[model samples]
Target chain A: MSGVADDTAVVVDQVSKKFRLFHERNQTLKSAVMRRRRIVADDFWAVRNVSFEVPQGETFGLIGRNGSSKSTLLKTLARIYVPDEGRVVMNGRVSSMLEVGSGFHPELSGRENIFLNGSILGLTRKQVTARFDEIVDFSGVETFIDQPVKNYSSGMYVRLGVAVAVHTDPDILIVDEILSVGDGAFIEKSRKKFLEFTGQGRTIILVSHSLPQVREMCHQVAWLDGGRLRAVGPTDEVVAAYGASIEAESS
Target chain B: MAASYARELIATRELLLNLTMREVKGQYRRTALGQLWSIINPLATMLVYTLVFAFIFRAEPPPGDPSGLDLYPLWLMCGLLPWMYVTRVITGGVASITNNAGLITKVYFPRMHLPLSVALSTGITFGVELGVLTIALWIFGGFPLPWLPLVVQAMGVLAMFATGIAMLLAILNVHFRDTQHFVSILLPMWMFLTPIIYPISLVEDAAARAGEWILQVYQLNPMLHIVEVFRALLYDNRLPGAVESLAAIGSASVVFAVGYLVFSRHERRLAELL
Candidate 1:
């Protein structure tokens, strides 16, 4: 709570998160009791002493290979996983789209899901109600809005989900691999929305494997390698270093 | 910190209300009877109990009744409706956290609201069941109109109790999947321990044979006091003593406090665990 700065949107002060890699998941009562002994070797640090600052109005990119803790860092920033060490401070309200359609109930209609998803993203019901038509229009699923989302095509599902999510009006948005949603046209539309959103002085942390998109959209970039911060700076420099590393590894 | 917690809860009141609405709506969706099944479920169970206990076994209602209705079906319902609510809340709540793994892993909110909203949604069904019970009573000339206020108080206390237990079980089920199966097994045993179909007076003979502490320990079950209060108000049309109602409320508060503490302690880790 102490790190309050006007220009900083988010601060991760040496944050670390650890996970227990149980050889046998001790979820069952018999195993939990039988193997009460703890093993230090199984403890894995997913985010290790990673410190960075995302200034207000910046679109930050987190880039790494699959097991490099990029998503875990974003999850920590979302407060989905509390940091084991240090702290994360945010200057404004934070919302995350870690996965598209994260909270959509298949049984619920698109209209119900709008309210439900909006509330999940921390928007009040009145806010969702005010933007209901806009959301439905943006998703372009107004024709089938009353039908259950389970019946919608996968493209329609992600379209509605992303539409509701982006409209949450968050000061800082954390998105992980959400750009890979929907068909070509919808992805283009979503990219446009992301640019417009960042233009309004909101901060975004984008986590994706698409290097070209990251290079295009991110003003600042942080590269993580094996749960540690490898390099962080302007997008071009870090992306060059990240690209060179991938080339070196592949060679 | 507790003040801030309460303030945070108040600030997120809309999420709680919407989530509860979602629970209530999603549960009965696509069902033939819709939400009427909420009322009919308990009503049918009450009739089944009435047939087996009242007619076949000839179980008597508690002897001392000012309103003098004392019918067995009415007696069974006085306790059964609240019992159903409690069980629903616990069973539903234990699954609430695990069931919404997608939401918990992706978004952040006050996690306690999940179980609390589940309990509240079940309370909606409890309300419908109580209304059906009242109408049924009127049809049978045993409507406890004068005791409506007391029934309201009983519902509040019962909800508090159920929410507390639900919160505790929900968190526990997250850490230990066995807690889910454990609770499912524990519920039927819990019902028999409480005097839903029979009166506490029936246990008097057992207390005499065993010891006085038998009944005292039985009364220690919070559900017993809740059932007793409901039975007194709904079946006998009499007000329970001040001490009795206060004891039920106090015990409920204690469970709720403990449950809240445990839930808050583990709530943050739930995202990682789930």
Candidate 2:
């Protein structure tokens, strides 16, 4: 459509990542000195020749089965893992809600983790201070903010993480199945926030197994099968193809 | 490349500050004694060492010095304070990457900030402990007033050197879990090699023949110069002559450079390794 859209927020050009599976990790002095070329059992390409362009303000859904390179592709896009080949260019502030409680320290209070998670998500101290009340209210963990997060129930933890991520105001947001962690009410709240974020012209890349949600939320969708792109296009067409493939296999 | 690293560091400074505060608070949180335990840990060690040397061994003060200062505890504390801080930072630093696997795997901040935050956290404790020692010195009337800057400078040098080493060790430990065990064995031997327990002057007197060569080799160990600088500032009036000070600073800078280089080089693999 219009040859690579003018407002491209993220561009991944033929990116690939290979991880060598070592039979025995040879880090010891004796093993290193012996130098009998340690075995490489296999080279696993976690993301192989994956390419896509996400335009600014677009809601892009990445749908795939488990071990289908969805998470790996997100990580590479997030710059957590460097691609072994090709390149990824991003023209905005990117924040990933890869794991809901990724930055929470167990011994820290919910209030402390708010600042921590906010900072990790690239919000400055002044920014977090200004939005502190909004974040706490959004999470609905107001009364227990001073208590250590170790005391937080699973529902509270997920809610707080989502609340922080939403409030950080990143230009490019990546959500990886984090919505599945929280309660039903929190999920509804998260969806509202996600819609608001996208409405404000922020790019959102969502990786979820829920095909119906992907079809509803995404303008475009990409399907990954075994570390390779199976199909990518309008959400309805791609999802239908993915469904057909899955049903045929099941039959 | 350097500018990018510095920019990345500046970007993550907030995270470093928050993590450091978390570390300090987490240690004392829910504890009966709270922050006092930081002071108590080193003081307790000093008491045991003092008892063994003064009562059991019947050790005496420096010859011909009628000040009657029980300098053993003072000497022990001087060396022990910095040594313990370094050891704690190094040991805890390794876990900085491994323990935060969740953050490393998910987030895209400079991973060097993790170990650096640990070093900075320990550094706060070291500063507090130094304040305690200052009061102790004043109470004993053994304050080396003129050399205060030198002692402070030595502590700063040692802290920076240790920060560099800790950063390197943390990245390595993520890849090779055995580094943790190797460090446990290495620290004690490192202490013995440094003139921590016995002064370099004492060792020199004990072995006159090969003492110069041994002392020169000892100088090669950066910590030896650090401890010597500490002793010079606290006990002796001024820093070692300009030549020795320059040598020590040069060695420390080299180690720090190497450590940072190694840490930054390997940081990319930390997520996979962890």
Q: Write the per-residue lDDT of candidate 1 for residues B1-274, one digit (tens) a residue.
A: 5567768888998889889988888888889989888877776888889889888978887643776575688778878989998999999999999999988998999888899898888888888888888877767777588788778878988888888888898888887889989999999999999989877777988999999999888888888887888887887777887767878889999998888888887888999888
Error of 2 at A77 (Å): 0.6
Candidates' lDDT values, in order? 0.87, 0.82
lDDT of 2 by residue, B135-160 (tens): 67657866566666667787778877
lDDT of 1 by residue, A1-251 (tens): 56467888999899999998877756777776677655323889988999999989999999999899998899999989999998999888998999888878888999998998898889998899999998998899999999998999998999899999899989999999989878888888888888888889999999989999998899999999999999999999999999999999999
Best by DockQ, which number? 1
Docking level of model 1: high
The C-alpha RMSD in Å for every predicted model, in order, reads 1.6, 2.6
